[model samples]
Target: MKTDVTPATVRDWFSEQPAGKLFTMPTISAIFGVAPGDERRRLAEAVRCGYLCGFLERTETASGRAYRVSGKGMRRPTLEEGDRARRKAEARLARDDRKRRARGAPVSPNKSSRVRAARVSLRAANMPVPATAVQHSVCETVEQFLARGGRVQRLTAHWEQMEQAA
Candidate 1:
């Protein structure tokens, strides 16, 4: 738990907790070795990313909320790690955009999914890429799309196309 403190590890830890164990914010934070405030955010992120369940274990507290692990096994990356990965990807995207601009090529803020798929395509095609290239993230692209007032109605093929476009 001390070393592999990733989302996956945390989910495992949550499962190892007693079946009906309820955690106060500070107690949970203590388990994670982070501040209660930070743990609150991390817990929310973990739940949002599907690593944990939506419902609280105890909802009748007057001071604050209490939580327990669902142990449902829907784990994903932790938000802090995701943020770091996102910043790294955006940096790479900005660098690529700069290069495109320097070459007098068309450059706009990129759609993250397309960029990711394009990178995958490049790898599959065995094309030579600049050594400085970095991986792109779908979340970054979606953020730009949202900033431009784009909306997703449903997750049909058309919506998927639009998501890639975004």
Candidate 2:
């Protein structure tokens, strides 16, 4: 009898396997009656979900990448649990986005113009101008630093003090 191949079924199979018994992708595909080509793609997604949901543990072996059942019991994660995980991940990402924006460059109409002028002046002085992406990154960093009431001072004296101590 042909068994239905699904993420839950795959998870169950992994859970049934003895702990630490490694099974590679091809071995799994064959055991689950998963065909090559398009069917393999679906199986791969199922395996990925199993890994993500903590139903399986992946590791590298001498043969290749392999997976085994997680020591965490056979209890399947519910739909609500999956949704909660998704929400938590989204909230973390949003928090990170806010932090990045808080530390990012101030939005100003003349910001690009100022960056362009700086690059032009550097080139005119025969100094190697940084690439456009790097120039923007440096400009943002400097703007953020200055906006925070920070000042740039030559660190030569500090370095000389450290050198004398050494």
Estimate candidate 1's alpha-carbon lDDT, on a 0 to 1 scale.
0.63
Name the TM-score of candidate 1: 0.37
lDDT of 2: 0.79
Q: What lDDT does each candidate get?
A: 0.63, 0.79
Give candidate 1 regions above 4 Å deviation.
1-4, 36-44, 47-60, 75-166
Question: Model 1: per-residue lDDT, tens digit, 3-55?
Answer: 33345555566667788677766565667776446555765565334423433
Q: Report, for all candidates in order, the number of backbone clashes.
A: 0, 0
